[model samples]
Target: MPNFKLTISDIKGKSVSKELKDSDANPLLGLQLGNETDASIVGLSGKLKLTGGSDKSGVPMRNDVHGSARKKILLSKGVGLQDAETGQRKRKLMRGNTVSEEIYQVNCKFNGELPVEAPAEETTEEKAEEKKE
Candidate 1:
């Protein structure tokens, strides 16, 4: 059997080169970049596992608590969480209560032939058979 190794890099030119040895039982290796950057794999084959890794601060990755109202309140304000049943307006911790937005759009141009159209649907009338002679 042949051995497999790979080198993956991000758009910022920062790269991580890894060599897979038969002795290295762990088939998966993880690399974490900053929040603003993304890792992209190019020109390699075997199996690919691109995952978000540990934080740069050396702390373990945290699971998303999207449904927790307390977590949402804490994130929205720098103060402690509020009573869930109180129904009180939060004091905007930060200067502004605005949220920053980032948008990504991809546009590509291809000169290849158009894709083949799918076969037309057949109605019940079209499928009805003529009376045999």
Candidate 2:
């Protein structure tokens, strides 16, 4: 499939955007943050700032308070293990070592109601104007 930027938005119409470089396979080449040898933070999620006024009084809303997880792939290149058969030199590869999941919480509303859909109907004066037109 095509790789496109993700623009996460909230109920108040505030949003945060993120773009990923085009890749042949996965498209979204996961960002290998921090030290590679230490651990691989794969699918960690976070929040972003919004542009409009605060959703809750003076408190601003966070756009992308998402959740994610991480996994351990192969061992570091230099952190080599003994060669089982060759006995010369080699590095052992380990599959999934450990996976970590994380969720970012933020203050925001996700109701499915729009501003135009106000519960109170238009006044009689407004309706009269419409009828006259």
lDDT of 2 by residue, 52-113 (tens): 21211222212221212222223323222333344344433221111111111111222232
Scored against the true structure, residue 124 in model 2 reaches a CA lDDT of 98
lDDT of 1 by residue, 1-133 (tens): 1122333443344454544344341323222112211211222333233322222222222224221112222343222333534444553221111111110111111122223348898876666743332
Overall lDDT per candidate, in order of appearance? 0.28, 0.28
Give the root-mean-square deviation of each candidate in angstroms. Answer: 16.0, 18.6
Error of 2 at 35 (Å): 33
TM-score of 2: 0.18
Clashes of each: 0, 0
Number of the top-ranking candidate, with lDDT as the measure: 2
User: How much is the lDDT of residue 7 in candidate 1?
Assistant: 39
Could you tell me which residue pairs clash in candidate 1? none
